[model samples]
Target: MENNKNIIPEKSGSKYDLLLKIEDIIKKEYSNTEGIVISKDGEMIYEKYFGESNENQKTHIASVTKSILSILIGIAIDKGFMEDENQKVMDFFKEYDFIDKNEIRDKITIKDLLTMTVPYTFEEYMEPLEDFTRSEDWIRYALESIDGNGEKGKFKYSTMSAHLLSAILTKASGMSAKEFANKYLFKPMDMEEINHNDTKEFSFDTLFGEKIEGWANDPMGISAGGFGLKLSTRDMAKIGELYLNNGEYKGKRIVSEEWIDKTLKENQNGYGYMWYLIYNAPIRMYCALGDGGNMICVIPDLNTVIAMTSSFMMNAKDRIGFVAEYILPALSN
Candidate 1:
């Protein structure tokens, strides 16, 4: 069982036995990876953990939270919280633009934020991330950061800019993003309850808690959209499962099939809504990838969902290779 790491096995096959051989390789190679969960044809066939981690432990999941936020955005649309993804960003936050000083901000749509094509004042996405997260009013902070620069449709990615979406969701739903997520997304999917981070200020420890479940928020109580979500390895798989089932969980529709079809299709960039679409892989799939090896991959053709998490590190994108090189080929056989 590879040092007692394999946590669950609902079913198995020759491919699973083959996949098990690579477990030791993954453990020795990706030393920081905390957990891995794989499911095929709707049954969880394998679950494992490493380095003092387990199935219930919630990793920070970093920017993978962006993809989950995208699902919540779809749910918001399905429930009629906002007219559509094409709605203007400024329409929800008149307080941020009372003077109407930024004409470009008025034209920024939710789609621009999802695709990360919205214009920004900073050249590097990290430039404003810390300052934006620490601000007393982050929604307004994110709003003021948008600039015309005449690059609205150009794909300039920013974690801080994505908070605009959480703020928009807050305004549209008349509840905090966490509340909306709990009511519509998490609960419906049977995921563990998610609570707000106690402090308005961000903390790494809150995310690393073995049992403490939390989602971060700005001082204004808007949930962080670009980052700051703590999810268990299996719960992340549940998300992939939800998408693989076309936005239904346990036969109940959570997000529309239309939303699922729209969000999974490759866009102009490699992004599908907030998901990173991968066509070069052994299978055509999409991923919610985060820093240091966190991922939720949905391979529709294979009817597979894979979820994983790791301690904070730099080789985060390597999880994609874990799929392309190992998981998909094993499944194909």
Candidate 2:
């Protein structure tokens, strides 16, 4: 809707020529995809959808949901619901007695969860859960399930940490993570297409004849972090735009510029909060990476945001790199 010339590069030949080439790449490189690349100023620069983008076209965004959750954390901080990332997780869940005793667990802070260094092992506990939601005691299960494999600040990538943050947010804000996100993050961004699905009564097909149902409406439930997020490609691009603009959209400051700057900066292992910091040659980029090849990359130096979705197969990082390396150079020149 705004002026797109500032964002999209000037046409060297013709826009149709670029679109045709992109279409060919999508067809050859990715078997099934719904890809869209938007300029930082909010213009649709390129798009290609191999399959139909109807109701059945919904693709699981895997961990890109983590970046959304990170933004929600920013909103919570902005609203004074969260003091800071250093705030203790125990303080939020005061009513829950399950985590009251453990000294190490008490020391776990919101920062620890955001950085994925919560010192917990989710795999040890998750395998046996017949029904995640019906467990009736998610907090106790999570606290007890903690493995304490390493000391705090040691980098470890785990889904359980994100799940823990979800629980802490629910306790602190007095609302479900989805509800909190809807109020603070989604509504502000006008991201109406995004929806959170609880895993209650869900089914997963196994290699054997047995069918698994209701593993845990959201195995992370209040804790179901890391994954369990569904979003459209357009909505994903808006998130990148928000970050690129330093957490401002439509002249309203949704998140503090300070928080956005800190979150986008590289941390231990190129991780900051939930987003991955990529130090690619000319620019230092921040990206949200999901399983099965879903990526939302924001290159601040180039003023570019690339949103992509692929099928169950194909490597997302490689495909996204191709755009960054090959297509972007040609388009910019």
- Model 2 root mean square deviation, Cα atoms: 5.6
Model 1: lDDT to the true structure: 0.80
lDDT of 1 at 41: 83
TM accuracy, model 1: 0.91
lDDT of 1 by residue, 277-317 (tens): 89777668999988788899999888999998877875445
Q: Per-candidate TM vs. native?
A: 0.91, 0.81
- List of clashing residue pairs for candidate 2: 132-215, 132-216, 163-223, 199-217, 200-217, 218-221, 220-223, 220-224, 221-224
- Report the number of clashing residue pairs per model: 0, 9
Model 1 / residue 289 / CA error / Å: 0.9
lDDT for each residue of candidate 2 in 1-333, tens digit (9 for 90 to 100): 111121234544654355446655666666556655556446666654555553223455667767777877878888898898999887876766763356677788888778777666544334333443345665666666555544667776766567667777777788777778777777888876335445544343210012321112353456245555556677777888888899998787889998897687666578888988886545567789886678888878778887876555544446557666656665565
Show the colliding residue pairs in model 1: none
